[model samples]
Target: MKEYLDLCQRIINEGKWIKNKRTGVRCLTIINAEFEYNVRDNQFPIITTRKGFYKSAIAELLGYLRGYDNAAQFREIGCNTWNDNANKNQDWLNNPYRKDKDDMGRIYGIQGRSWQRPNGSKFDQLKKIINNLKRGIDDRAEIITFFNPGEIEMGCLRPCMHTHTFSLLGETLYLTSYQRSCDVPLGLNFNQIHCFVLLMLMARFTNYIPGKAYHKIVNAHIYENQLPLLCNIQLKRKPFQSPSLIINPKIKKLEDIETWVSVDDFIIQGYRHHGAIKYPFTI
Candidate 1:
């Protein structure tokens, strides 16, 4: 989408270079920035500048909604994105809180679907949102937050796309996704897809039409190793028209998503883009 291309170009032109301590890599970083996607026009925000893996993106999102806390579960769902962080991260492997093999601890879907309370009770954030939406309630608190302060030490990595707030206006649904940190080259590609598709799915089960998706980024950066690729290769390409997402009409309820949805159930039409650019990913 143009918005993605613009954000990338803005980072290239305006970002400041800094040495990131976590990955020991240089980053072209920028401060607060935002973008929006119009779901009402059926705009699927997969990056057209380079080959975007819609299936992996969708799978990751689905795995989160299913409350998966294991990397094996994500792999079963056709997403190996968590493999590196879950199994290969030496820091997490050595941490005392790290559980058995392939455990991601309490992060993302684990926190979103079953957040733990001080009383040792579990709170289902996703279920609550769906239930409230079903009752046509727009109480300005339809939020699903994956950032758990208490469990940060237990997880392999903190959530970048941490919170999502859904708003209802009449019969239309809109979403605003918040991110604390963003790896512009690698993470943002999948993130845009996640935000737009998330709104689409939420609207589907809640009896509302998808309206728009907004992404708010607090710290957006392109890794120094990835700058050459984004500037010389990926960013040089032209973006095609935004594609349309096709979800299974058979998905009639929220529970159906947990047991019935797969990558095959989602399709994207008219997606034409440049070949894949293997930008360097840091854990």
Candidate 2:
């Protein structure tokens, strides 16, 4: 992870800074990593020195995954990342195009229940992939997509913009995600780490031994305002530790079974370190 931080710093010193929708101005670039074979029990991709914007990130992710477009629920839970858009004068409250009329009408429910590809398919891709895994179908063809090109045009934040492919090889599954841009300090770094954790949980829910998730960040750029923070992150050193697993003995719905695979189980090695260092950012 130090290597990643160093590279990000070097890019900041030489890269261009530009304004982004999510975090003002940022330093952006393209990053590529090639792997010879599958790597197992690898270091989790999360940064340990600082809290990687977990609370808001998790709320936003759950809202998208569950298909809840409203920020009311998240705001009540101390999450306000989506409030900016949800509070706008776009009539999101009564938009007729909203597929789900109620809170249950979320992307997860729609995708898990009413999703169909353009070719007249009647199955939810995500659920189908999970069922296939339950039946022990280990192949590269088990990929599920969350990006809907049609929806992207209709004012929806592009779904699963980062994650592109998921493949199961034996008990371990490998994931490939593409990000056209990243806020290395504020958003992208944390998003990748959380998404990796989510994927691991999904793998365990389907009774597969959770292994390493290969995160491919294309066009990986850091925000200029966050360069100072990245430098401080690089200076920090900590040993990684294997994550511990937590399982719920009682299960009700399939969703509950899925939730039983706790995110806490997917631990980043050696993140426990000294107090937070001050890394101020100047745009």
* Candidate lDDT values, in order: 0.91, 0.50
Candidate 2 structure quality by residue, lDDT tens digits, 185-232: 555545555556456546655767655555555455665555555565
**Which 10-residue window of candidate 1 scores lowest in summed lDDT?**
1-10
TM-scores for every predicted model: 0.98, 0.68
**Number of clashes recorded per candidate:** 0, 12
Stretches of candidate 2 off by over 4 Å are: 18-26, 31-44, 53-56, 76-78, 88-123, 232-254, 257-283
What is the C-alpha lDDT profile of model 1 across 1-283, one tens digit per residue?
6777788889989999999887888889999989899988988888888888999999999999999999999999899899989988888999998888899999999999999999999999999999999899989999999999878998999999999999999999999999999998898978988999899989988999999999999999999888888889987788888889998899878787799789999999998888998987797
TM-score of 2: 0.68
Q: Pick the candidate with the highest TM-score.
A: 1
Q: Best lDDT goes to which candidate?
A: 1
> Worst 10-residue stretch by lDDT in candidate 2?
33-42
Q: Give the TM-score of candidate 1.
A: 0.98
